[model samples]
Target chain A: MNQDSLAYLPASKLARLLASGELTSVELSRSVLERAEHLNAQVNAFLGWDGEDLMAQAEASDKRRKADKALGFFDGIPVALKNNIAVKGSLLTCGSRMLENFVSPYDATVVERMKAAGMLVWGRLNMDEFAMGSSTETSYFGSTANPWDLTRTPGGSSGGSAAALAAGMSPITLGSDTGGSIRQPAAFCGIYGLKPTYGRVSRYGLVAFASSLDQIGPFGHCVEDVARMMEVLCGVDPKDSSSYPAPVSPFHAELELALTGGRPMVLGLPVEYFKEDGLDPAVRRAMDEVVAYYKGIGWQIKDVSLPNSHLAVPTYYVIATAEASSNLARFDGIRYTHRSESASDAVDVYFKSRGEGFGEEVKRRIILGTFVLSSGYHDAYYLKAQLVRTLIRNDFSKAFGEVDLVLTPTTPSPAFVRGERITDPLQMYLNDIYTICPNLTGLPAISVPCGFASQNLPVGFQLIAPHFEEVRLLTAARAYEKGNDWHTRHPAL
Target chain B: MEHIDIGYTAKLARLELSKDEQELYSAQLGRILEYFHVLSSVDTSGVEPTAHANPLHNVLREDVAVPGFGAGPALANAPQQREDQVLVPRVIE
Candidate 1:
């Protein structure tokens, strides 16, 4: 393969090539850096880059490979970390103006692991401000246009990560999923993204959005690549108290776990999930076909119920906003970050800097969050949402006891045309209905391509597994992908 | 019937949306809050309000200081830096 084809190699493939000496880490890293510089004007997948630093790291990896001393599978692959994952000395903006020039002094636990595993950190990708929005449109940096069609969205706050993968600018990336930020964009951008169980991966150094709901996971071109990256990044980290302490299972080996004859897995469909009036025929058609595909492979199917699910979106917003409001309070001007030039006093600077720095959607949520948690209203709104959240989780637990996994369309319709829904906030929030509830419940869910919709945009079929049951979900997802060429259909870049 | 004041919301949000923007947000938030109000009317006498999914318990970590980034490298990229820490323009009180 030529140097440019190095841009298109998946993480697993890139690793294989590097292992055999057919390609050096220098060739792979340089190929992608040049590609990112050239193609970034089109998709705007990155927020920052380190050309010299990347080359230095790649050369070191090449040395390790030559000496037959190296880290595990990911030793030479070029990957991007979502800006939320701090890499020492890199700008970690999280796509917000508030942190526009803020650079981190330390590596996040995930970044530390990525380096230890021999992966070269290319740069940071753009995102919704603080991982709060469903689309990258909420970014202060600007929206990332879909690679499939520059006129539409690439889904967010991990839109840049997925766009990078889809455009072949980067083969693997790390994205935080608070409320479907990873999967929604991955689906819209036609790549594979996973939201592992809430504690499956460490959250250390991820700028907090909703501490409980936020999880960091990988975005890759294929299921095996996600499994490979997860193996390095998933194990318990003392820095993050919430990371699961159990040994990181043999995820790479688990990927080969087959789907055999006769109900090897149970697939459940929650009828209420796809019941709104504005459902797209293309998405529904894709869902029906996904069901038939699984059935043909001898998997059992049933229509399960999550009765309180209708309340999930509101509940998610309440808890996420409240957590965000508190977590974001530390960014006040006193903290050595963005401050207002016009402030005559400390209080004014804090309020005004934050006021101007945050985007409109962010300001809206902060106000709503403050109102719901203020002295008099907590019992009425926040508490009520908490109670509803319990019912939602219980419903999923019961459904899981009856079936091993469930399938749903990752988004309500398909990727919306850019500038189409930004004017209508409610319509924008509804775009993630199918994916957010899983975040609220902390289940393991993924978006894998199932079919194409229109204008060459791909539709992702989603699968949800019980908390920490990612192996089962990956096995089942690979089964679905193996049956069709969904992952192979890249955008016409 | 009851209602919320947009002026209060703007002050709390620390945003200065114009009269037109307030009017727009008020109407939109009003509809959203109205739906939430309907949710409140439903009974929840026997329900337990869960806070987090991992059976919320106090998770404590050891207080020992492990190695962190060297202060020099840590401060290398701070837009403004001082004595091993970050610096900012004087925030008015």
Candidate 2:
């Protein structure tokens, strides 16, 4: 009931124990707070910690528990929000100088939902600047090390959230995935991360990166906990115009259904994913183990090709950066957090304020976006990427016709040493090679622990489902998790 | 095919790169752009460019007026603020 070993207790059990009087929410909160404080410095996963407020909430939850009130499923649960996610009055820096001190006036739709569910919002975690890089190293705040190995990175832009969950800094952490941000980091850090189908969760209050590609999701050590967090966060929001209006299903309802009673379904292996420098030898072994386990459970496996998947990375960069440039323009000193003191004129201020405020990665992408969208270059760079995007989408639509789910190695390798890929951007880009295509096509994808590499770091197998198919994605993940103890394994802080 | 100047690209990329930073990204981006230029080689003449991965449609909401901009803390942290809005340096062109 103490749940000290974040490695041991599932969230559902914690909820049950706290409800049945075996434990109090305050005690659980303090245990996590103590663990977080002990391990946070090693990983640098959190940017802020509201320890006192969290305890206050826990005490309130305790009061409710003692009074025999109907405690919500996630009541008194301590969770962290990615720095890019707005938490009212919390520094919502999107890992950039642009909003270094920006505070949100209100909660994001996901935050509001979690708040309504009685979950405690603990603090904000680190991320890549404007969610740009494949590793958290791009963060203006500096990088988050993989809790599994301090020398290596927790693959990012959601690296902080993933690492926080891995180190037990929080029970779960919310992350936004734009082209593998969540899952890749989840893979690297040895935790569970999901990118729900585009439009599945409300984007309102999420600091925009690419309005089209970004979807908020959750990271946890286990599949069902991730699903529970997903159920609470996924929904329609009138404020988020781009969110789907479809009724949000109870992620748990179908979750148990998928594990216990769901039919044995086809799992597709895309040939392209395994063709070239596809996966490290050990990771390939991990994939084999995952597939064999699924086959052992009578699930049919097949090979399906997403022919245009090869174009996915380029397509994603152009579309995501183009949207990023537009969405981030609001951060100009005229409107938000920081402005320049040196510029004497309006034009000078426009250039200098942004120049001073944005980090190199943010500037690089903005300029890349500006060039791609400029009149003479528009049709060439931006339009070409968009065309390739169509092909990527078409390929997925075609492949989905053949199978219910597709599996691939999440990252080509386990967490690489921090600063290892700093000099080589393309190599870092390739880190997301297998994961980006899903975001390009608005598919729901989840990364669950498969096995550990030689360095004792974790490797992940990514399962992607057709859009709006969170149920199927979570089902396969839960299925794989139950038969394998990979999901049970946690990083030694 | 158009070639991007190293100087222009560096300026466009807004990097005051140390000689190494400039040289590194230049080589890296050049290779990527060259490979990506294959998109130019593809026949997309009649194909419509897709901006979104999902099907494109409007996500418009009712334009009813709602009160917003709770400026209490927003103004508190401002380097400067006036009348519940952010204050900025002079901007007349």
Question: Per-residue CA lDDT of candidate 2, range A1-493, in tens?
Answer: 3445543466666777787777777878888888777877889898878889999988887777677664478787878889988888778888888788787788888888887877888878999888999889989888898988999998899989988888777777889999899999999887889998888888888888988889999988777788788878887788876787656788777878767877898999999888757578988899888889999999999999977766777777777777877776776567665777886765555556777788767766775676677668888888888888877777888888999998889988888888888767667777888888878878899999988989798999999998788888888888887778876777665
Per-residue C-alpha lDDT of model 1 across residues A251-341, encoded as one tens digit per residue: 8686675544324689999988778677789999998999999899878889999888778777877788778777777777555457677
lDDT of 2 by residue, B1-93 (tens): 344454564454433344654565456666666666766666666667676655538877677999876677557667677888877666664
Best by lDDT: 1
TM-score of each: 0.95, 0.94
- List residue ranges in candidate 2 displaced over 4 A: A1-3, A6-8, B5-28, B70-77, B83-85
> Residue by residue across B1-93, what tens digits does model 1's lDDT show?
235576786576555455776677677777767666755765777999877766436778768888766877655645457788877655543
